[model samples]
Target: MPVPPLPNAFLIRPIAHRALHDGNRTRAENGRLAVEAAIARGYGIEIDVQPSADGDAMVFHDYDLGRVTTATGAIRQRSADALANVSYRTGEVGIPTLAQICDQIAGRVPLLIEIKDQDGMMGSDIGTLGSSVAKVLRDYEGPLAVMSFNPHAVAEMRDLLPDVPRGLTTSDFPKKDWLLLSDARRAELASLDKVEAVGASFISHKITALDHPPVLALKERGIPVLCWTVKSAAQEIKARKVAQNITFEGYLPA
Candidate 1:
């Protein structure tokens, strides 16, 4: 199937919020900074979702809480209420639920939600995160879409939230703390070999891997290729040459 068109000309990924907010050294994935970026810059925002211990879909990035919060341990170990008390390293914002984020944005701009499910660690219910987010989005009248590096999660969202768009997040499998998967597993995730089976409507690829054959092939087939984390004007220039859109952070793109 051909990929669907993006709701916006470009997306402002949450990671860029820190740079846009006077170079705040704290995390940028979720909370007020991201909402500010979206509302102030008039760019669509990308958010990552993870389920809390009580199964509420939370707007967060890492599976573990140590990086962003003063608390430690996997995020799934805490209920939404518990996570709410946990402050970010900045000490101003606590972990916000997906509902809170939606309320904050209030359909002001498009939302690109990236579901962060890995190997079913969050829950046995394959659709837990998608279903949770769907419930919150049920009455929302904004342009939004669900995406995931895990294709299974994406498919679940497609089934439960048929009206919303879906995409697959891909990368060159860079070795990072969040990417604990082995090279073989990373390759499988990045290859897009099972995209047809997953039924992804579009792709959010790593900026450096936009030229990979699978990505190029998808672009040729009219799948909208959106690249991520373009940190500078120079990188944005390069990525825009090949990608249909960009999910950028760190600096404003020209």
Candidate 2:
């Protein structure tokens, strides 16, 4: 099957990283408030999902609850209901399920869903996160896509939801930053050897590494290049030299 193209809505609008979250403010990342804020501003919403203990997809950025919530443990250790009731220290809102977030968006704007790497080593040992995300997105009607830093997860989505557009979250994979990944693994990922095999329609690469040779090579082939965490307008300008769109936070795009 041919790779599906990303919707123009996604390519045109600046995607808000973790929604329009303001860090432990009343509008927490991936919370309903953040989703609403992004919707109101007409920015594309970006969120991360991981499977709960019950195999339900939860919209959250961290594998652990320590950063955003009062609790401190692996998010997967909690059930869906338990997770839903755990409030953010600032927002007083519980974490939401993928289903709830989708229903909230209701096709308001483009949605980019990142499936957080469940495999600790970014290898083939993935959990049910992909399947869990697929179940919620199967019936969803919107301009949406799924991606992952782990190629294995993207491959899983290809088999489970062939019709939805998917991509890989690419990075330069600096050794000190990614100590969990061995040199061989980082080398393979940096080369982007899995793009075609995983059926990725686009790549959300690191903003700083937009100049990476493989990423530029993919763009030369007409593959869409999206970049992550562009914090300021200056970064956006630099990233746009190669990236077709951006996932941004900390500052609004003009």
lDDT per residue for candidate 1 within 24-97, as digits (tens), equals 35544577775676578777777788889999998888889987678899998899999889887766567889
Listed per model in order, the count of residue pairs whose N, CA or C atoms clash below 3 Å is 0, 0
lDDT (Cα, tens digit) per residue for candidate 2, span 23-102? 76777888899999999999999999988889999999898999999888999999999998897988565889999999
Model 2 Cα RMSD, 1 decimal: 0.8
Best by TM-score: 2
